[model samples]
Target: MREEVNMPLNLEEKKELVKEVSDVLLNADTILTADYRGLTANQLTEFRKIARTPGIYIKIVKNNMLKMALKDSEYAVISDKISGPQILATASDNPGEFAKLVKKFIDNNENIELKSLAYKGKELDLSEIKKLATLPTYEEAISMLMSIMQAPVQKLMATMTAVPTKMVRTLDAVKGTKN
Candidate 1:
């Protein structure tokens, strides 16, 4: 089916769209791009529903508009992959969780193609994105590290308490014998 051409956005709307995209770029902790042209409307809706969770965002952008919006930003590096229709996915604080979610959908659909992923001033390929998806969530990773760090301290405290406990037990036994 021939696609109906969308009327060009006027200068003002274009400017607004650019700003909107710029805000997304500045706020996202990690960003990923994928080819989304093959997703059906229902699939897109389901994708949007999944994306509505906190720290996750999904956008299907007009390639040219995104190019204009990403200029001078770190996201500009990804513009090269924006040659055709694309899906822009972002995570504000939980990049691993976001990657996992997006990858789940991508795995389910054969048509969905990962283009690129960006995080912390670095551009990554689909393989890296897969690695990212397997990572523990930020909070989980932090807690796991904290537990590892605290293990020695916890053991030290228990040992210290054991000495005092043994002394008290010894004193009590001696007192019982005297009585």
Candidate 2:
């Protein structure tokens, strides 16, 4: 006969898990809490794809555990935003990029919602996060500026091409005067 098995984690194991999570929280630049309550399994997987491309990672945590972990760190910005069944998506370098990605996904998949964003220790509302997503990335905006600035130089070159004919006309007028 098969016997029932009951296994409980020792104190050391629980402490270790909390420590690992705390380290992750401390190193992250931004932490966004979102509700995945209505997303299907496939939708959640799609969301993961977009998040991971830009070095963003997601974790599902118990509200109380996350609250305890974020109590003393920059994550305190959104510590109160945490709700039951929240998924924490975090980025190590640039939170804007991550927010943009998440916002894009939410835009296309309306069912997927953005609960709150904690950017560089500042809490942001959903509308604010959406604005961040609509703004072009820093590099893209710079390239657009470079193109706009080059237009005047191009026009100046076209105007200078007629210089030779104008100079010849002036020389002809001078010869007539001498005659």
Candidate 3:
């Protein structure tokens, strides 16, 4: 087996990386950082495949570079969780859905541990992230709202039809008894 040489990223490459991370951060609705130290390449690839939703981006960048990218941004609070072998995952829409995806991956992978998550510039602990994961997606929420809104109308219509049908039944019974 050939030993792989670890090459340091040059100044231009580092700058470009920081820029790319910054751009992602600017549009992100939620940012999740995890300690991916014990995860193998295959496990990481599996996670990437599971996280293939649109507007989601995941990367393992140098801590310093990530810090530089996060500097002066709303996500600056996440720099505290940037130490060690951290994998950053961000999504532009539906933070709860992103949290659910990360939670599912963590549940399946014993080696990976959740570090912290930042949403709307606020830092949240693992428990809070779990709560976030339980939240419904946008489509689910809309469907739920529609059902709730229709319930009263449906009940009213049923009640109105029931009164007329009951009167018709009573009239038929009275006419039969008279005959």
Candidate 4:
């Protein structure tokens, strides 16, 4: 029989990890919890690389460690779902963009399972999370709004000038005909 070697984190390291998690959660706009079981090491490495975008961070922690970190957080609501192999994704961006990131990961990896998403102090169910994923990012929404706002003004300006333009062309035609 082979004996297993386990070197658990020392008190200091645990404290550091806990503090880091708490701080990340505190500053995050949204947190997504997912199970990363059955994913290969290579797959995880690739996923991590993809997740290195701005405003996103991922931590895979034991349930106990995560619970300790969540103790004083508005994210305490999700502490109950902390069991099993998990990934804690904290995003500093708007919730929609974070949802897009998580949804992208979920779509690429079959082993990754979406558990729950926390945003605005509320725990969103899976369906709500999916809907959020489909939403446009802050930039996209802003551009869409700008285009919508500009369209009407542009049309009004074009229409206002078109009448004068047509009248000028009509007078030019009449003068040429008389000549």
Regions more than 4 Å wrong, model 1: 1-8, 161-179
Query: What range of 10 consecutive residues in model 4 has the weakest lDDT sum?
Result: 1-10
Error of 4 at 90 (Å): 1.2
**Candidate 2, residue 48: how far the Cα is off, in Å:** 1.7
Q: Tell me the lDDT of model 1 at 32.
A: 82
Q: Which residue pairs collide in model 4, if any?
A: none
RMSD of each: 4.3, 5.8, 3.1, 4.1
Regions more than 4 Å wrong, model 3: 1-7
Model 1 agreement with the true structure over 1-179: per-residue lDDT tens digits: 12556776778877787788888888888888888778899988888887789978788878888888778677788778887788777888877888888888888988888888899657887788788888899789999999999999999999999999999999999999999
Query: What is the per-residue lDDT of model 3 for residues 60-112, given as tens digits with 9 covering 90 to 100?
Result: 88889999999967989878777898888998999878888888888899999
* Ranked by TM-score, top first: 3, 4, 1, 2
Q: Can you give the lDDT of residue 26 in candidate 4?
A: 88
**Clashes (N, CA, C under 3 Å) per candidate:** 0, 0, 0, 0
lDDT of 2 by residue, 26-101 (tens): 7787678888888889988887786656557787667877787788777776777778688878877655677688
TM-score (C-alpha) between model 3 and the true structure: 0.91
**In terms of lDDT, which candidate is stronger, 2 or 4?**
4
lDDT of 4 by residue, 1-179 (tens): 12545767778878889999999988887887889899999878876774678888887888899999988988898898888998888887777877876777778888888777888668888778788887888899999999999999999999999999999999999999999
lDDT (C-alpha, whole model) for all candidates: 0.83, 0.75, 0.87, 0.84
* Model with the higher TM-score, candidate 1 or 4: 4
